[model samples]
Target: MDDQRVSILERIGLEKPLVQAGMGGVSRHLLAAAVSEAGGLGTIAVPGAAAIASELAAARSMTSKPVAVNLLLPFARRSWFEAAAAADVVVTFWGTPKRRVPGIWLHQCGSVDEAHAARAAGADGVIVQGVEAGGHVRGTEPALELLERVKAALPDYPMFLAGGIATRTDVENAVASGADAAVAGTRFLLSDECVAHPEYKQRLLSANSTILTELFGFGWPAPHRVVANEATASQAGPSGEIPFINKLINRASAAGARFTPESVQRRAVAHQSPTSRMLTPHAPSEDLPRRFVEAGPLYAGETVARIDKLLSAEKIVTSLVG
Candidate 1:
């Protein structure tokens, strides 16, 4: 690895600066440990702290390096505070920060106020996830603009920039724009260590760009970027408001197997506004593409267009440092 990469790792209190962003189901033990073993900060995105202890135990079994875990606020399905206290770092997205935990709280921010609020919430660091990001966007500001504002406000705060980060130039630009480090999702999703399904990875590597769509579940109108596909391109026009979409998704979820074949078979996938890029799942099996017909939407980024191969965590980290 490059010397600069080593320095970045030290600065972030890790062995490498190449910290992998949280990706729900995708950030499994293998991927997280692989990054950590390679000297970067590897994190497990636990919707809550429910399995924090078990996950941590498993992570320890994989590598003794520092590991972080993500706690999702928007989902609100689980609470991981107690379990997270045992981790080296804890990242929070979409939720108000609470008491100071042992691990770093990487609060995801889109607006200036949220940054300050995260600081007040005892977050050790903050990640500015711009609207261009694949999974969920918190702000309308371009990623660079948001990073600048965040740096001006929280000069001392450790700021990790996400959304649309795909290339080596992206990393260098982020550092010039005042970001201490860059967090990548789509790029890492294609790694060999990544547990994403094979077909999903192939589709991303084969495509020129991924779509940012609006297939929202729960009350969260989370924007997901994916590859252009049948579900996304077929959603011809706006189905309804956020509420309407939520209700429909809720009905579909509740109906389970009882849902009408039409609803279950409803092939229209919601694509992000202003773009046709569709989100592709990271499944290991070829059957996943068919399974996703009713399965959840794939959350990815525009940078995925640049992902073309499966590199090891070490190669990915070292290349970024150079």
Candidate 2:
């Protein structure tokens, strides 16, 4: 693509219009820096910034490129906001735009109405993520319609389209629809740099249609698009109670204890019924159980089906740009 054709990409100091959407726990140091180094926009979720300054340092050490840190609204701890205030860029997710940061604030919006609201609330930019996204399901309108409405309502704002964006056609379609850029999560999730567990990537790559569970927390009612794992398959409807194993995981995590696979399995076995056998050997960390139990449906997008192999950040950027 010509330089002029990707004006917004240049404005963001990127060679491509693709952005690696921040995936909270999964969007850590290595992944974020690699994405930026590869000439695409990279965003880091700073949930662990307060606790693990080393992670932030690792990201900084990896690249000098512009990196945005995600700020989740209504977090039990406000450290993420503080981290955002100090970041090169800030993205607000699952939160009301009441807090103002010095850096650019890319407020998460599901519809044109929300985009306008975010603009009015002082967001520097608005990321228009549609319902087809992997991690969190937001908005009822399809991506194309929502982008049209957003472009019509906020002509001056730099609007970015997200959700189920993976292939070159998706990028072309986003630009044709007046989007300044396109954000993709599931595509990046399958990359070699993504910190997601091996099993997580494998599951995402092999699954046809992952389950969308509405049980996760962090305020909004976003759905998690997870592959049908033992944990996800066992999840009940919205009314189903959170198991004691998950409760213990939450409790222990809040107290500053690191969760390892063994510890989590022990806690899970103790809390869950004898029939529960969701724990598997290949799982990388104990956090998987917590993510499945507490943060299920493991938010994913429809585009995950297209991801066949893990890719390097540079290769990923080139493919996205093409």
Candidate 3:
């Protein structure tokens, strides 16, 4: 890597150019702190302002290293910006690029156009997410393929590659392909520090394939990649319109609530509702029903097939970039 790339990593206090993707509710204080302390950038997914603030404080208490917070722009309320701004690095995804904080801002882009827009909007960096990524995918192409296109378009911009990254070779390839860093989500979700339920983790260990579907798009409506399970088997197909009832519940969840701690908590636990399939298996007290292991969205990247063991977050970071 060149000086510019080194500086980008240094600016964010990342000794290793690896970032743990902010998997909503799953990537909490323990996971984030563990990654940061292990030399990579750790990120906490923010559902709302209150959760962001609380998570940041908790992560800070665990490690003095710098940490990041991610906000899903499409579902984020305006007040969430305040809490997001407090983090060392703020990352936004799934919407238009806008500077809501004075800190280093990075936007996740699904296409070259979105990458350009993020750069034009003054983003310090951009994460290129491809179809192989878990959770809500942004691009239809493969991760490295999209990374190449965006890098050619914005040669000088800081870029990170996300999706299907699980091993040391994956990080090496990302850096060699002109990425300043590599971001991994599914791999981290299986880490010891991650809060994903044991059953969910077991499923990932055995899963060999992932399907992209919009079935759990009740509130988000975006295509997400997940391991095949009962929830996905019930879906008619890979693509379709979100159900009317889901849209209603999604709107109701966001209706007129300020981004306070209480309101944020409600939205974070929205999966607990019987009607929604977006279960937060990371939340121990959510009282997720037994069927959730097979019925809820078990987000995973294409790399899930290669991951078989649950390692510590620190061990995972070291294995990737040591």
TM-score of each: 0.78, 0.79, 0.88
lDDT winner between candidates 1 and 3: 3
lDDT tens digits, residue span 6-99, model 2: 5445555666677889786677778888888887788776444463355667788989887777766645245546655665667777656654
- In model 1, the Cα lDDT at residue 290 comes to 47
Question: 1-322, model 1: which lDDT tens digit per residue?
Answer: 3354344346457754456888766676777888888777888864445556777788889998888887666443334567776777777786676654664567878888998998787766678877677766676767888988888987767777888777778877887777767888877877887767676677778878555545443234455565654444555234312234444664445323222232322233332222222222222223335445324445667777677787887678777764
Give the Cα error of residue 139 in candidate 3, in Å.
1.2
Error of 3 at 293 (Å): 2.3
Off by over 4 Å in 1: 1-12, 48-50, 76-79, 236-290, 293-295
For model 3, state the Cα shift of residue 176 in Å. Answer: 0.4
Pick out the ten consecutive residues of candidate 3 with the lowest summed lDDT. Answer: 278-287
- lDDT against the true structure, per candidate, is 0.65, 0.66, 0.82
Ranked by TM-score, top first: 3, 2, 1
Superposition TM-score, candidate 3 onto the true structure: 0.88
| Candidate 3 regions with alpha-carbon error over 4 angstroms | 238-287
For lDDT, candidate 1 versus 2, the one ahead is 2
Candidate 3 lDDT at 243 equals 56
Backbone clash pairs for candidate 2 read: 134-299, 134-300, 134-301, 135-299, 135-300
Model 2 deviation from native, Cα RMSD in Å: 5.9
